[model samples]
Target: MRFEIIGNIINIETIAVGSSIREVERLRKTYGSGRWRKLKGTGTIQLDDGTICEAELHWYEAHGIGKKEIKIKFILSE
Candidate 1:
């Protein structure tokens, strides 16, 4: 799993792996039209070990039909 946030740019990647999550909040400041897609938000991730972390999430994707790539970014863990 990887998370990074630089100003308006954000990136995050994660897999189920050994860690398990119970709940996820929501995202804000989201905007996208009929073309490019973009969104920004914050959420909480709980691990199987009961470790709680706060994260900022972001996603971006181009309009198409095949093999779309999604980029996510998380930051500030507690």
Candidate 2:
């Protein structure tokens, strides 16, 4: 859930954005009383020294694809 980004962003792409009218209205009071949207991004996480052997980074605004549901992706240098 917490980590340090030790490199500059080389390249990134937005994967998708999901929203539902019924779900948004149902949880409006909790998530906020407006149109609710979740985002997803993916890219290569590289070291500051410009190494090519980097890990694949996936970012999500909500929900999850890994251990924790974090909005930001942190890349640690080798």
Candidate 3:
């Protein structure tokens, strides 16, 4: 899965079929904070085949009073 984040918004593209909680945690730790802050909500993503997947938003917090960067990750259903 490829994770893309933009301004507190996250877009996830899963190319493989697999679910790992550890991966999610790694993603959260890698791109969860410092420069991004996770958005507390959900989004819908439309794939090339018109398949819609639920996207979760994560963001990085700015060091000071400035604009913050956003990152996104996708969650697969169990």
TM-score of 1: 0.34
Scored by CA lDDT, what does every candidate get?
0.40, 0.41, 0.40
Off by over 4 Å in 3: 1-40, 60-72, 76-78
Give per-residue CA lDDT, model 1, range 1-78, as digits (tens): 543333433343433211131111111123322233344556665545666666666544334421123333544677
Model 1, clash count? Answer: 4
User: Could you tell me every candidate's TM-score relative to the true structure?
Assistant: 0.34, 0.33, 0.28
Question: Judged by TM-score, which candidate is best?
Answer: 1
In terms of lDDT, model 1 sits at 0.40
Clashes of each: 4, 0, 13
lDDT of 3 at 17: 21
Write down the worst ten-residue block by lDDT for model 3: 13-22
lDDT assessment of candidate 3: 0.40
* Candidate 2 residue 38 C-alpha distance from true site, Å: 6.6
Runs of candidate 2 exceeding 4 Å displacement:
1-3, 20-53, 62-78
Winner of 2 and 3 under lDDT: 2
